[model samples]
Target: MSQFALLGKRRFAPFFWTQALGAFNDNAFRNALVMLVAFQMGLDDHTVSLYTNLAPALFIIPFFLFSATAGQLAEKYEKSRIIRYVKLFEIGAMVLAAYGFYTHHTSLLLIVLFMMGMHSATFGPIKYAILPQALQQGELVGGNGLIETGTQLAMLIGMIVGSALMEIAGLGPLLAGAITIAVALVGYLSSRGIPEAPATAPDLKFNWNPISETARVLKLTGQDRPVFNAVLGISWFWFFGTVLIAQLPNYTRINLGGDGSVNILVLTLFSIGTGIGSLLCERMSGRRVEVGLVPLGAFGLTAFGVDLFFARPDAALIHGLNWLAFLHSAGGWRIVLDLTLIGVFAGFYVVPLFAFIQSRAPREQLSRVIAGNNILNALLICCAAGFGLGLGMLGLGVPEIFLATAVLNALVALYIFTLVPEFVMRFITWVLVNTLYRVRIEGTQHIPEDGPVLLVCNHVSFMDPLLLMANLRRPVRFVMYYKIFNTPLLSFVFRTAKAIPIAGHKEDPQVLHQAYDAIDAALAGGEAVCIFPEGGLTADGEIAPFRPGVEKILARRPVPVVPMALRGVWGSVWSRRDSGLGRARLPRRFRARVELVVDAAFGSEQVTAASLEARVRELRGDRA
Candidate 1:
């Protein structure tokens, strides 16, 4: 089903609108305040600068102070109720904002900004934590994509509408105020339709002190190294985004020679591009939480970012051109394409990380982990602000700042990928699989979401492990012959994936025994392991006779055994179709159609080498 189908379901639709509306109101109010302070109030340059600079800090402060507490609240109470209360708080804040707008009370409006920030901080944990409770495992990525798409568009629209409303003469503040309050009310109404989500940690003790709780929350977030790295990756995204967004207004004015309309045009293009990318993730990932896209996203961010700098290296000779005029100028469309792709890549980069965190973190601690993510995001955002300011102080123009950020993004991505080689490994696997074949997967639901399972499959091609890795939602450790495992160019991926390499007993008894031990240990620790009972790849696109190795492993560890088969890969590039010749042959067809069929798992006691091989052959049928 399309991810959009979630909009028709009671489980998702209400919350989606609620959150989207909340985002709309948040941006609307903030941009409206900016308009009031910067343009309408007639403040001096320094005072305007002071208010502009202070706004973001005022908004972010609550996250640092209340995120831990909010996390606990999300964990200890019913989520729907909390959301209702949050909306109510938003309503109250907007009411006060309406008063401030009418009276031209700058202090009161600033206080309202702080209140809005508090609203966001309180909502952050529940925002992510409730998704897992409400969405199925398969829907996680698509759901996240929709949420991201909604947020991006809503925020963009809110900014435009709010600023436009505030730009109106004599009635700007009143209109902005009314719209914000109405949106807040609508958000509350939509939230009322959200289904109940019971707390994951209802029995846990609550800690009220922010300092101690914040420390504890951070520590809890780091418990799972990969998840914590995902959090850091997310935070880095905020940092990168902050730098880009902070520079855009000036970049539009100075580099593109565009007026305010052009700035909005750039933002609209970016937001639309992000929404497109977000929606494409489900199709790209085949409804799985695929981290492989992260590396791809990182590469695009750097590539397009550098291209953006090179696309226009100097300020325009003309100033104050409208958006349409700017588009007609030299290199205009190129700039548009660069900004849009950056946003597209940003979507690709972030959606999977969020899904990974949701799928991998302990349910009880997920809320706290999200809260930790928020806190770090806020900190990185601040740092990004400073980084931009520092560059400006260094007399670097916006284009130069873009260039530096792109370089730094490359470095940061390299560092993260090095720390977690699995991301890179998966990227390689995903790329190879997607490039070589159009895979149709069946019966994946039979694969357990968690726990140890032994996967037995036909040994048809060298690309089998990677194909399976790309398709399966959960990670699988494959057992392969040492020679294949050590193959040049592919060894890095194998090692990073922790594939167990073995040799025949006659050739290397030590390696064989060690492989068995590793397999057993992995299964015992609740990991899935795949092994080809045929012992080696088939030489002639036929199933080789089953070997006894699988039986031996299962005797030692009586885990479930899932039989799997791959079709149409027998003549592919990595297969042994050219074993009789000197070199591998090119595929007769590019992107050859392939099928992966997984049967319901057999209980350990019910599986034998002969039976499992027969089942795999039956699954493969005459497809090869």
Candidate 2:
């Protein structure tokens, strides 16, 4: 189903609106307060600047101080109930904000701002952690995409609404306060519709000390090296975004020479692009948590960021161009395109990382891991501010700063991809599989969400493993023939994916023994392993007799064995049928229709080589 279909389901829709409304109110309240202070209060420039500078710190401090505690709460209590309570807290905070607005008291409004920050900090863990429980494995990427799109659009709308409301004569603050209160109440009402998401770790001992819990949660986040790096990648995204967003206003005034409307125009373009890119993730990933999009996103970010610099490096020749005037000016649409594409790439970069963390992290500890992620995001946001400021102090122009950051993004992405090669490996697989074939998967539910399972399939073509890797929600360790494992460019992917290289006994006895050992270890450690029980690819479009290697591995490990088949891959470019008299035949079709049929797993002791071969052949059902 389309991800939009989720918006109609009771399981998802309420929670979606609930979070989106909260995001809207958060930005609305903050921006409204900024407008009141900067315009309505009649304060000196120094005082106004001080208050504005202090506001973000107040808001973010809660994440630093309370995130671990909030994580524990999410783990120990029901999420829906907590969300309701959070909404109630928001209503109360907004009431205080209304009073503060009426009296024009900056200090009181700042305190309310801090309360809202605490509100968000508390909600942070539940925001992501609840999705895993409420959503099916396939719905995960789509669900996250919706949340991202909602949040971005809500934030942008909230900023615009809040600022516009506060600009109204005489009753601006009152109107802003009223709208915030109403939104908070509506947010609370929405929360009531959210289905219960039971605590992941009930009856667990609670940790009350923020400092120690913070350290402990960080340690927990780092326990998985790849997950930790994924967290870091998420934080880097915030850093990049913070820098880009922080400079946007000045970039509008100085570089584009556009008025406030033009500023809004650019922001709108970026936000819309982000929403588009986010919504596209589910379709692009084929409903899987495909991290390959990360590399693609990173490349776009650097490419456009550099191009954004080149598109308009110097100041505008004329001043005070309205948004329309700016667009009608030379090179305007190029600038717009650059910003929009950057947002699109930003969406591509972030959505998968969120899904990856959600899918890969331990369920019981997922909340805490997300809390750790929030803390790092907060830290990186601060760093981005400093980074932009430092660059400005170093006398770099805004465009130069953008260029420098883009270059740094390339470096950081390279470092992260190198640290976890799985991301790049998956990217290559996703690209190849999606480009070459239209893949259809059946009975994915037959593949267990967790634990060890041995997957046995007919080897129809060289792309079998990559195809499976791209489609399966869970990661797989493929056992391929040693010769295929060592294929030059593909070898890096195999090694990074930790594929086991096996050979026929006559070809290499040691390699065969090592492959068996690796298979055993992987299964013992509760991982899925796929082996082509045909021992090699089919010479014709027919199943070969199953080898006993699978039985041998199961005899040692005795995991459940899932039978699978690849259909309509027989005549693909990489298949044996495409090799005509030692010359490669041109692919008969591009994006050929391919289906992966999976059957229920059988108990290890329930099957033999003959029975397994029959089941796979049956599943193949006349399709090669």
The whole-model lDDT of each prediction reads 0.93, 0.94
Output the TM-score of candidate 2: 0.98
Alpha-carbon shift of residue 13 in model 1 (angstroms): 1.2
Residue 125 miss distance in model 1 (angstroms) = 1.3
Q: After superposition, how far is residue 431 of candidate 2 from its true place, in Å?
A: 1.3
lDDT of 2 at 221: 97
lDDT tens digits, residues 225-293, model 1? 999999999999999999999999999999999999999998998898888888888999999999999
Candidate 1 wrongly placed segments (more than 4 Å): 581-584
**Clashes per model (N, Cα, C within 3 A):** 0, 2
TM-score of model 1 vs. true structure: 0.98
lDDT of 2 by residue, 1-624 (tens): 999999999999999999999999999999999999999889999999999899989999999999999999999999999999999999999999999999998889999999999999999999999999999999999999999999999999999999999999999999999999999999999999999999999986999999999999999999999999999999999999999988999999999999999989989988998999999999999898999999999999999999999999998778899999999999999999999999999999999999999999989999999999999999999899889999999999999999999999999999999999999999999888888999889988899999999999999988898989999889999999888889999999999989999988998899989989999999999999999999899998999999888778888889899999999998886888867447565656568899999999899999899999999999999989
